[model samples]
Target chain A: MRAVFWKELADYFGSWRFIIIFAVICLAALSATYTAAQTIRGDIAQTPTEYVFLRLFTTSGETLPSFIFFLSFFGPLIGIIFGFDVINSERSRGTLSRVLSQPLFRDSVINGKFLAGLTAIAIMLASIILVVSGLGLRMIGVAPAPGEVARIGVFFLISLLYVGFWLGLGILFSVLFRRTITSVLAAIAIWISLALFISMFAGIAANWVAPVDQHSEAEAILEHERIYDSVMRISPTTLFGEATETVLNPGKRTLRGVVLVREVEGMIPGPLALGQSLMLVWPHLVALIALILICFAVSYVRFMREEIRAT
Target chain B: MAPPVVETIKLTKDYDGTRAVDSLDLRIEEGEIFGFLGPNGAGKTTTILMLLGLTEPTLGVAKVCGHDATREPLKVKRITGYLPENVGFYEDLTARENLRYITRLNRIPERQASGKIDEVLEIVGLSEVADREVGRFSRGMKRRLGMADVLVKDPRLVFLDEPTAGIDPDGASQILDFIVSMSKEKGITVLLSSHLLHQVQKICDRVGIIVKGCMVAEGPVERLGREVVGGGQNALEVQVTESSANLIESIESIPGVKAVECSGDMLSIRGDKDVRAEVSRAIFENGSLPLHIRAQDYTLEEIYLKYFREE
Candidate 1:
């Protein structure tokens, strides 16, 4: 397993695809950061600390501070590219048959690829985080508080897991599609529709789908809206973005003004509490892990049972 | 009385509704260079894939070095090294890196790997190009590197699918020579598959001719040649001074003459037994001056064409 892992890791760095991905992610994050910095200099300079935090969490601009939003939207795209051709390329090149003829088990090949991709993502994320954080500190002219540092660490972890979800999805598509181009195109289509288009149309979809007649009871209307939001959040990217926002800012209570209000008269939970935020997103986390495992399981079984001679 | 290095008992493989390999019964002896000769889609690759555990047989069993290929693929893989048609390596890495990676995956002892890598590189004539990136190498160079990778593990049995395909004649001859020497000097069993009849004929002691997923004929190259070209009997070509129609009739009427064809004054005769002396005596007795009489042996090309054209 270690041998396979090391070779895959070397392959990732040795290939031009990895370099291109790293450059794209870095350039995108830096562009977002620059825009955010310009906006911070222009508006609400004397706002209170809570209001400043809220603005940082809610707004998307061109400064390093706004990179979290760009990353959440763009990171999954990178993850998909990383894995969409992993197995298919090997098969096309005729290397899969040769590799399988060795003493290593098939499961190790899948596991090693996953670990290598994950490691590459971690490296990319860490470098982006380091560069952005350094620029942010320089611009703010103040060292980050320990709480702020902790929030950033949590955000990094969330991004890693978010990328993991997409990596698994791409690998599943790779196994299911015989052609590498088809697998990559399929992944891109899913990304464009779910990541970019779904959220943009969520409100309109909700409005069109929901019954807005005045005769309808408020409870019924609220129930209808809840279903719409749940369905939209089914996309792991959307769920992870919303969760990251809640974790990083800590005070934002609702995402897009669609909140699941649970009436609890006995005790009022603190809105900015980290533990509360984690609990709220626990289901998304579970779903992400489940999706990753399912994709991996499917890829493993298919590759093991697949006729290598077919390619 | 050593066990067969590889054996298949009525092995079969079906793809979708079509049978790719139908009840293939094969036994390859240890240290023998066996040729699997067939045209495209003749199940030669399929059979090799099944033996290497890259594909599952639909029915019956295949064993490599006494290990059941389906149920115990790892054991089979451990003893077999396979080079697929159009074999590919990590082009971005150096040839040495590619061999090193395969060697590691095959779990060659760490201490012995460096020496084995060097030895295999030298064996494949890639020692001078070891440090060059595989992407920059020519196709023939890449193929040699691939062979080195296969041999790095020192496997007992090797499956080579069109190992010399696409190579220059000089490179192909070098590879064939190496294959023959490996089997003879190291006692390695080799199963080489090829659509090119002459390539296999040059190196293999025994050849199995397959057509449309069926083994039509199999035997030592000389024996197969004899069987297909009429049992080792030579064909005699005679250019007589006089009109040869009478000579041809006389030759056909002579004992042991199988067939006779006459073109102008030239007569060609095929016989089941050596009849050169008898033909000369008959020609002399018929009062015809024999201008030229030459005996010719049947080439493998003739035998291959004869058998392949049968169905």
Candidate 2:
């Protein structure tokens, strides 16, 4: 296992694809930071100083840490591209057969590749966070509190796990498709449909499918609203981003016009509590982890059982 | 006694209801270069994959170095090195880097890995090209590098699938010579598959001809040649000064004459027994002089053609 891991790590560094991916992610993050800072400086110059960082962190509640959102969107894309050709490329090159003929176990090959991809994602995310944090401190003229730093760290973990989800998906596609192009296309299609398009459409579809009938009953409308929110948050990226926003800024209100009014005579717990927000996103995390495990399992079984004769 | 390097009993592999390999019973003795010859799509690559445990057989069992390939793939893989047709390396990595990756994957001692990488580069005559990326290598250079990767591990059994395919004639000959020398000098059991009949005839101690997924014939090259060409008898072409038609009739009537044909002043005769003495005497008696008589032995090309014709 260690042997396989070491070799895979060496391959990641030895290949130009890895270096290219790193450069692309870093450049994307830097560009996003620069664009956001310039846009806010010109448009929101009259706003209070405290709201500057808020705008940078949450732009219209749609993007989180503008840089983090950019990284999250591209992080999984890089993971998919990095791993979609992992097994198929080796098989095409005939190296898979050669490597399997060695003392190494088949599981070691898949595990090694997965770990290497995870490591690449880890490094990329770490570098992006470091760059974002440094830029934030320089621009804001103040470092984030320890709690904020800790939350961002958790956010990084969530991003890594999200990328891992796509990496496994790519590996599974690699096992199922013989051509590298086909595997990569399948991965990208899934990413675009599920990660980007599906959630957007699901919300609109849910609204159309279950319209709020205000004349019927107030409780019925509330139930319809909850269903819409749940369906919209089905995408793991959306859920994770929203959870990060809520965790980083505890005083934010929801789009549904629910505000935390501390002056109320008797206050009931709102939905913005950290633990409650985590619980709301917990299912997405579980589902992503499950999807990753299932992909890995399928890939492992297919590689072990599938015939490897060259065409 | 130690087990045979590779053994298969009634091994069979079926793909989509068609038998790709059927009841292949084979034993490759330790330290011998066993050549597998066949026409295109003869299941040679499929059989090699099964031997490496990269593919599962539909029936029966295959054992490599005394370990059952299906049940104990890791054990079987531990002692085998496989080189596939159209061998591919990680093109982005330098030749030395590729070697280092494979060496580590095979669990070579870290201290010895650098030395082994250099040793294999030297063996394949790629020492000068060690630092060059594989993407720049010619087809023959890639094959040599692939062979070097297999050699680095010191495996007990090496499965080389068309090791010379796509290589230049010179490089092909060098690879063939290298395979032979490795088996002879290092006692490595080599199972070589090739569509090139003559190269196999030159290096292989024993040959198996597979046609349409069935073993059509297998034996020593001399024996196969004899069997295909009718019991080692030579075909003779004799030129006579006189067009003695009676001499042809007389030679055709010889006791051991298998065939006799005459065109112009030449007569071609094939016979299991030497008919030279009787033909010369008949020509003399018919008042004709024998100008020349040349005996020709069967070549591997003839044997290969004869067997594949049955397909």
Candidate 3:
């Protein structure tokens, strides 16, 4: 298991494909940070300095999106790129049988490769976040409080889990499809549908499930929101977006649309504690985790029962 | 007598509604190169998979090195290695790096793995290019690298499925000679599966001819040849300058001579054994000078064709 893990890790880090993608991600992230630092500096008096460090991830400047936005959008691409060809390429290269013929259990192959991918994702995301935070601190000229640091750490963990879900999906496609191109296309197709089109799909489905107009009651609007959220959560991107939004912006307390003013009439108007923020996104975190496990488990079972051929 | 290194009892496999392998039984002893000869899709690979525990058999047991392949596959895998057809390596990695991964999978320590990698590379004549990426290697070079990979683990038994496939004739012969030498020097048992009869004919100690998943014949090359061509029958041809009146009678009277037919300048004799000397003497004794006498022997081609036609 260690052998496969180390080898895959080296492969991921050394391949030209991975290098190019890593460069794109870093450049985009740093650019997002540059813009975010500009916004924080331009309006220093208007914003509170309490969570100023966290603002670096959420604040979008004139030309670029926030760091968390790019991560939420590109995290699946990283996972899919790492996993889409993991098994099928081995099959095409006629190495599957050779590797399986060794003294390792069949599960070890999948386990090692998956763990290696996760490690690569973790390293990439961690370094990017750290670099962005350091740049943001340098630009904003404010040290982060311990609580703010903890929130950022949890946000990193949540992003890892979110990307892991996509990694598992990529592996699942690799196991299910024999051709590398086919698996890659399948992974990308799903990513496009979920990331770029799922919210649109959810809105349409929610409208059909619960119709609402200007004359509709507040109860009807709430029902429509409920359906939309449920449908949106079908995509890990939505869950990731909601989780990171709440974690990085601690003042946000809900994942649903505001249907009535009375809902927050008695609620506090300040950032919640770290535990409270975690509790708020607990379901999203659980859903993301469940997505990862389900994808991994399905691929695991399929690979274990798969008939390996040297084609 | 030594215990059999590999044994399969009534091993069968079915895919969907069709049976790929029937209730086939096979036994191979230590230090023997057993040729699994068959046409395309004759279940040669399927049987190998079952023996390696890469795929489970629908019925029956495959035991390798005294371990049930299905029940205790890791143990079987530990003592055996497999060189798949068109064997592959990580194209972007050096030969040593690719092999290091295998050694790691086998749980060999780094220092030992490095030594073993060097030793196997030396054996395969890849030491000069050990650090060169495998993507730049020729097909024959990759096949040799595959051999080095199989040997790095020091397995007791090796299953080579069409190891010489897609290589030039010179390279194929070199690989065959290498296999012979490896077995002779290391005493490692080999189960070689190939549809190319002549490629394996010279190196295999014994051969099993499978047709439509059934074992049609199993034994040494000459034995199978004799069995398939009819019970030990031999064909002999003789040329004489002149015909003698009683030469035909004399040749027919020779012991073990089944029949004799005389042409203008040639005599065709059929017998249970070599009767060339006796027939030549008979011709000379009868005043008919004999010029040339030759015996016709069976090759693997004839034997494979005969069985394949029967099936």
Candidate that scores best on TM-score: 3
TM-score of chain A of 3: 0.98
**In candidate 2, residue B120 scores what lDDT?**
82
C-alpha lDDT values of all predictions: 0.80, 0.78, 0.89
Error of 1 at A135 (Å): 2.5
Off by over 4 Å in 1: A30-65, A200-209, A213-216, A253-271, B231-296
- What DockQ does each candidate score versus the true complex, computed on alpha carbons? 0.61, 0.55, 0.84
- A1-311 per-residue lDDT for model 1 (tens digits): 88878888877887788899888888877666656555655665664454243233335664354677778778778799889988888888777877878888888888999999999889889888777766655554446666666777777888888898889889888888989999999988988888767765766776677756778866767866775677679787777877888877666655545343454344455446677767777777788788789888888888878777525
> Candidate 3: which stretches are off by over 4 Å?
B240-243, B273-277, B288-292
DockQ measured for candidate 2: 0.55
- Model 2 C-alpha lDDT per residue in residues B1-311, reported as the tens digit of each score: 98888899999999999999999988889988888998778899888888888888999898998899988887877778888786767777799988887777777787899998898899889999999989999988888998898899888889999998777889999999889888888899999998998877888989888877788888888778767876567678899998666787888888989888889998899888777888888889899899998776666788889876765
Clashes of each: 11, 0, 0
Top candidate by lDDT: 3
